[model samples]
Target: MTSAAGATALVLALNKPVYPLYVWFLAESAFHLSLLTALTMPLYLAVWHLSRSGKGRAARLGMVIVGIVDTLAIALILGGESETLAFLFACLMLAGLSFYRSEVWLSRGLVAAIFVLFVALEGRIGAPLMPVEEDDMRSLAFLNVTGAAALAAFIMLRFPRAERPD
Candidate 1:
């Protein structure tokens, strides 16, 4: 997920001409996007280290928090038109898949938080921090849609499947 986010941002930054609206006034919009995505790597690494240390619950909680906050921040930075909200759905999927059935409360709480955040911010948000051309928002939207889909698919594939009862 982290890698995908960074890669998408990089692609956007490198192909400025392809997204004129995105880079019209703020030629650095894509660059800033890449930077923000890169900044989340260390937090993801810390979560990985915690999981490796056998702190399963803490790691799961950390993942949920980091994923939610990161997605929300990106959505806010890009504004509603970029369709970055797609990543919030990815975050919800992560929370749902991160916990065992026994940890229902944690999963429910995290999912609810994501749901509330999505509802509150979806269309209610204002323009992006760095405004882009109206037509160019489609480019960002495409990147976000594919990025979110890839993240969701990767998460589903990587998570362990439940054992069947005899």
Candidate 2:
């Protein structure tokens, strides 16, 4: 999660300067998004601390909840772009991976929550809080897709693999 946050912040920061060339909205939006991603790092660190303290369940829940809320907030700001929805799906994947079979209910509930929110928001939001031009939207989509894919890959790589019998 910390790596995910860092990646997102880095992408946003790197794009900040180029945003103005495309649209005024992009610059302001990138600044706010960068700030938002940066702020989440401490929360992820706290979740890490909770896990280290033997509060596995709480830490897992905290990670999912924070991830969902953060993704949802960004989605709201970005409107119903398919690119933004990628992170919500990533959150669902995280929920599934975070829980064991004994805690399937928790995983199911979180996945359902993410799904419902995605359905409720997708295409329903008329316009983004900070609207961008069509060209700018395409650029933003690229950034979003790259960031979400990176985060998803990171999460999957971190998951435990079952050992093969010798």
Candidate 1 residue-pair clash tally: 0
For model 1, residues 85-138, the per-residue Cα lDDT tens digits are 888887798778778888899889989989998898888877878657656677
Off by over 4 Å in 1: 1-29
lDDT (0-100) at residue 165 of candidate 1?
100
Please, what are the lDDT tens digits per residue for candidate 2 over residues 1-166? 3333333334333443543343334534444443444445556566666666677777777777767766766666666652677788778877887777889998999999889988887777555675566666676777677767877887777666557899
Per-candidate RMSD vs. true structure?
6.0, 5.1
- Candidate 2: misplaced stretches above 4 Å? 1-34, 163-166
